[model samples]
Target: MAQMTAIKVRGKRSAKPQEKWTSGKKRRKNIAIGAPSFPTFAALVDSTALNRPDQRKRRRRHICLSTLEQLPTEILQDIFDYSANIELAFTSRTLWAQLRSQHVYMRLTTRILSRVLGYEDKERASSTDLAAATRLLGCKFMTWKLFRSWLEEQRPGVYRNTDQFLTAWSDLRPSMDLVPPIKLLRGPWTSERLSFLRIFSRAIENLLELSPPHYEVALSGFAEAVTEGSPNAVGMLLSMGLAPTTEMVRHAVIDSGCDKDIVIAILSHRNCEGHVGDVSTTNVDLLDPALWSWAEKVRRDGNEKGEWLTRLLRSKFAEIAAVPDAEL
Candidate 1:
């Protein structure tokens, strides 16, 4: 052990030489530490002191370790998805809005899906699975369009009319399932009263066209009033527009409970310009006595309820009385 130690000390004590170089006319000195036997090149290289604080300040100026908030929305989404908790995506409208509208998350998810299972395989699968998947993805419009096209292909021979087409397509309309209700209406329905009335009128017109005559008989008081107030209502019957066939008239008068006078008013008064004729049969009493009795009762009340009831009685009488005695 003593002999090994003496050899290591002799090796350490060996001499090292330093080379001198002249640059232009100036003589530059290369100082070696521990001279004669040993020297540190590391110490020679660091003659200019390291200004650590200044170095640190320089680094800080150029190397900005930016926070996540400083990044763009696309970059932020990519960063957030891997590290963020599940609750972060669902916590509020703001988060959901951020995720759903962003292309970054969509691309990330699509990439992951493509990697796990081949993307093209999904399209080659059965149509039912595709339909369900599309619905899950909230691409309902595309789903229904595809469905309708398939249906049309299957029924190649049949050409549906406008009414039939509307019925067939009704179910494919977009629903308000995802939308919040307050955003839909935006205000109280009270302000929409006139618009409601117009819609109600149009709905009634459609009902009259599509419904059986007996269905009209079952209408409530308010509906009866609306029909009575409409001047064009009875003309729909008398002009053969209602077909005026015995069955159609009976259906209108008996089943629909149409007012007799309104029916007469539509028939006896040409163009229904509201003129009373001099003909004896044109007299209200000379009309169907049963209907006249009902009309008198309706008129006696004279409110909206009365106007409606009287109008109904008058309409029914006119419809029934319009039939020839010979036919009866």
Candidate 2:
């Protein structure tokens, strides 16, 4: 009976070992069913691809940019006012469109003209003063009709007729007490206003200092224009019927820095060919000794324009000499 019991105990131990192995298998099966499978390289790539567009959208939402055209009208006008040149508006179509209004035009013209003419109190300027200033600045775009309309808008019924407006405009010069009046007071003034301003400002200085003869003021203005290297201003002055003298030409070549465009403008004037002959007889020293030396210096300095001016002047002199005094 003792041996049978011992045998029964051994059998029980063997059963226990089998049961332990079965439990271990069951635990491993449960782990395999519950835990996630390791992802493949392609699956990881697909997941990243799915997320990229959303990430890009999030980044895009965080960044913003504003363009010049998006700015307010007042801000645009302020930009125009602060700009170095009125031509800045012409750089872009959007800018030009923004600044094309009559109100903006008037404002810019008034501001720029006042600044150029050295007016301390631009706000105190009258309609007549503004009109005269516009004329002086050679505002080609500001037509008579436009100016009239603008004037009427500013001061209603002040100018009843064109004649009254003309009278007011004409009377502006005397009130300013310009001793020797500007030659071309009328418009179709096509010169660049900025270039005209630079040259005319200097001419005004000369006018105040010299107080030259009635005819000489125009001549002096031309001289100042030429000296300042403004070809357009010189042309405008000449168109105003300024008679260029021998002394003026000589001064332009010798005294004033020889600029090609200015010299060409003077020489190319309709009156220049005839005027050259007239002056040559009166002034024996038409071609000064200094002129040749200046030409040589200009050549040495490698200024092709200056060299061309010297050549043009020489050709003019040669033509004057070839033509008899009878025709002149």
Candidate 3:
């Protein structure tokens, strides 16, 4: 009887705990079904109003989101006043007025133009000014763009006032002793521009200094203009440095249309050098029809000295064509 009673007590205690757990589960289920679930926190947040950035007022209360474009012209002009000076920035009247009115844009364009012209100080510029300069210089349609292109092209009339900006300046030719060795300007070499600079070179000879390299450049340009076969070209070459050969000398005489004084001066220069081969030492009477009579007269006058005239005549000299007579 005692053993059976103890077992019943143990079973009653375990059953009581299980019964309590079942009663708690039933209560929780009843609450879950009966009670209405409130809106989630996410839903609450979603339902509330959010003020967007665009809805916020800009440029003070005067320039509202609704009537920003309808703002007074004077006010607009004042805003972009700096950019107004740049022709490229003010494309339309309304845009010009708007940008001109904005203090930021106005200051920006002014600073940008100054920087492109290399006039503005980098450190002193504001963030707005630097940003404006960057935009203007980089934009293809901007005034700074066109200005740089014109400079690179070396176009005349575009920078006519550039001469006035000079405190003191001289080119590399004559001022070599005075001027420091440095490159002042360089750009694309168009034939027309090269020709123009060649003339400029001559004009500035008195004011400038020519280093050896500069002289070489000028000489090369002159050489390119005239071929060796041309008499005028030969004259120019002789004037520069080349000495005349006896055959060359005689050829010049026969080709008297070319300036003889220039030839003589070239032959006389100490720096002039020449190689008159035996084949080119000949004085040929038949070389030029016009010179035939003079050759005969020379032969007749110097008949007794026949060997000398024969020695003077070289077979190879006949290859030179007479140059058209050119005035100095």
Candidate 4:
């Protein structure tokens, strides 16, 4: 044992000379601790956010270490698979940067949306998995254009129109039955429709809002919004500079209970050159008794507790009624 110790001591002494560098200029100085130089929260949001949520930019990042990071890659991946909130993984820049590269997370998100929505593998297609995975990563990091190309490949035949293409490709769309309330939207819906809307909200958010001009698509998009109980989708379109057609307003009136803000938004933007869209309808005047009856029924139900809506409906009707029939 003493010989071994003597040999170890000799080895250390022999290695010591090799450790010394023959020449050196100088060692680089270390950065100061807690430099107070991290990008501000507002700056991160500005740099990371794109014109649309799906476009993100690489920005200066802040990082923190965690014990979970030491786990083996496969083990940590399994843990990530169990997490429903992808944003939680985003708490650490390293984790977000690492996990997004794993295709397994994409498959995992596919299982989540598919299991909840009851879309079979055959109907939904793998392209949806990729698209939704991009969405799950946060809107800014999404690659929806790539997803759209995949969808086109998946359905070479019926890609007739963008709206239908989206509705069909997503496979997450609410049933037609889920739209229009059972009792004329007396109040917020008490069914599964709202849940569906909220679940897929971000996925469709930019799609409806950022789409280019299309004469025929306005109503179709509005109809999709109405059925989905997501007037905000149409509202987003309005915010994106699409003019509000009366049909859009009518869709809002169909059950303003869930979409009161959409009505307010349209009226607010009415004076903007084309933003208010034409309020023209068929032979029926804006203040038709039947329409008033419908508005009264909606107001009597639960939208805005009935007060504001009732007054607005009556006042608007009175104002429009005074106009000559020819001018209307």
Candidate 5:
């Protein structure tokens, strides 16, 4: 009975260890079944390595953007044609190189001039646009011949008719030979000369409204030109034998917004040479106290051009004073 009992005890102990081993195996199996199905760190590293070439290719493609110089010629030309500003061509050497062809220049000039002359809208140009056009016409690329050609193109038969009319009138009346010759009126067609024509055209239209005498109409046109602050207009009138009276000079200096250009134009004229030094009959000096006062106001107002003009006028006044009456 004692041996049987001892055998039962050993069997029970061995069964207990087997049961523990089975439980451990089952727990490991459950962990394996319930684990998440995500990629391991090793798998992620391998995938990244595989995609490296594709990533490099994408970066290279992003870096290889096309530049303006690489654009097709037609596209570039279209861009230039649409850009109305002449100064745009100067922004880049490539743009300048491509756009400075004679064909482009002529087309660009014509388009800008058309806008200035109000061909598109059939209205007169605004003051701002006219000023901009004047500056554009002063560009190095602009030429008198181009402007004249444009004028003829715009008014085809008018210039020809004008010349014919002038010739016919001179022939019909020999006394009309006293008038300024056709060449002077017709012009060497400078930009300034064209500007004068525009001013004179408006002046004539204004005079016609009042129906003034021919001489008064002509004189008023000259005064209007002076007051308009256009040096070319003033210069043209002076060149056409309009004497620069003391009042005219005083009016330009004191009344015409103290425009430096207009002042210079009047003082530089051949007709003005003798009169620049002449004092007014009203005891006002040609470079009057009123003009100096205006210059001082201009300086206080921070007009650099006006200040420079004042200095020029002072120098001119000094120069005149230094010269003897014998030279006069």
Candidate 6:
């Protein structure tokens, strides 16, 4: 090995010199031959940072994929509701539970509905007012289908078999009469005769995983159920007896557009799907393996049979459309 000699240069040509160390009574002196500026911990850190390879600007980590997740759950929920996303209950089980809170929806709806229906005071709703709101909306069973069981004095055996079913006050006539100004309302009116209370009540309540029962079959009222490709909503619709056919629905729940987990949930629902009702079918219905196999085929074969499996599940609305109300 050859011995290298230190060469000193002036100005920019000079290499940065190594920091010199001296014990006690340190004083400024002439620059050493090749000695560099004394480095402090901060200087070292800064140099280390400067030398590091450039990295892509780091993204902010959050509970959810976007920083929008950092906002208060209520505000996030408001965003979810105001935007095209409809409701979070259809998206995340955790977030839905935290944010879905039918209490809030029912609270706001009942308040607004009560005010609109001349039954509530906006500033301070009394217990009586709250009771009246609850009575009018009738969410006692938490779902309309369950309420129906109580109403008709019927066993839920038939409904429970399919797993879909809501509340009505005995004193209040069924909303079919569209009492008062409710009939004069907007184009989005449901198939049922909706009062202002019914409309607001249903709108608020539907911000849930499963919407109130009658609303599910209403023309165009089921928008939240089908919009933005919510797997929970899809599953709920199927559970509620919505036809699972591929034509009008594939656009809403396909893998290309929706979260994979949600699509999986929708495809895997067995009890809720119509395939189980078919006496002639020998194949197992909506099993994960079968559904995944079809999905894999779609991934491999390119949409050739992508939507074929969807035709197997039945939707409640489709079933209703297939049958006349008089017959129903």
Candidate 1 regions exceeding 4 Å error are 1-194, 200-205, 208-218, 221-286, 294-328
Residues 1-328 of candidate 3: C-alpha lDDT, one tens digit per residue: 4555434444434676656644656668867889655678887776553345555546564433335356775655554453434553345555544554234443544454444233222324344444454444334333323433333333333433324212111221122122111111112233333322332232222222324554444344333322232333333333333323444544443444223343333333232234433222233232444444444565687642333323223222332333322310
Quick one: best lDDT, which candidate?
2
Best by TM-score: 2
- Scored by lDDT, model 5 comes in at 0.54
lDDT of each: 0.36, 0.55, 0.37, 0.47, 0.54, 0.40
2 or 5, greater by TM-score: 2
lDDT at position 69, candidate 5? 57
**TM-score of predicted model 4?**
0.32
lDDT per residue (tens digit) for residues 73-188 in model 6? 87776665444232344465555555555545544443333333323223343544444434434422234332344433322234332223232232222222212121112223
Q: Report the C-alpha displacement of residue 255, candidate 2, in angstroms.
A: 3.8
Deviation of model 3 at 35, angstroms = 80
Give lDDT tens digits, candidate 2, residues 75-174. Answer: 9888876653566677677777787777776676555444333333222445444444434334445554555565455445676654555443333222
Off by over 4 Å in 2: 1-214, 272-286, 323-328
State every prediction's TM-score relative to the real structure. 0.18, 0.35, 0.20, 0.32, 0.34, 0.23
RMSD of each: 27.6, 18.0, 24.1, 21.7, 19.7, 18.6
Clashing pairs in 5: none
Error of 4 at 89 (Å): 2.0
Tens digits of per-residue lDDT, candidate 5, 47-83, equal 8987897655644433342486567766776676766
Give the poorly placed runs of model 6, Cα more than 4 Å off.
Answer: 1-135, 138-223, 253-258, 271-328
Ranking by TM-score: 2, 5, 4, 6, 3, 1
What is the lDDT for 117 in model 3?
38
Off by over 4 Å in 4: 1-65, 102-105, 119-138, 146-161, 169-328
| CA lDDT, candidate 1, residue 201 | 29
Error of 6 at 75 (Å): 39
Better of 5 and 6 by lDDT: 5
Find the 10 residues in a row with the least total lDDT in model 2.
Answer: 172-181
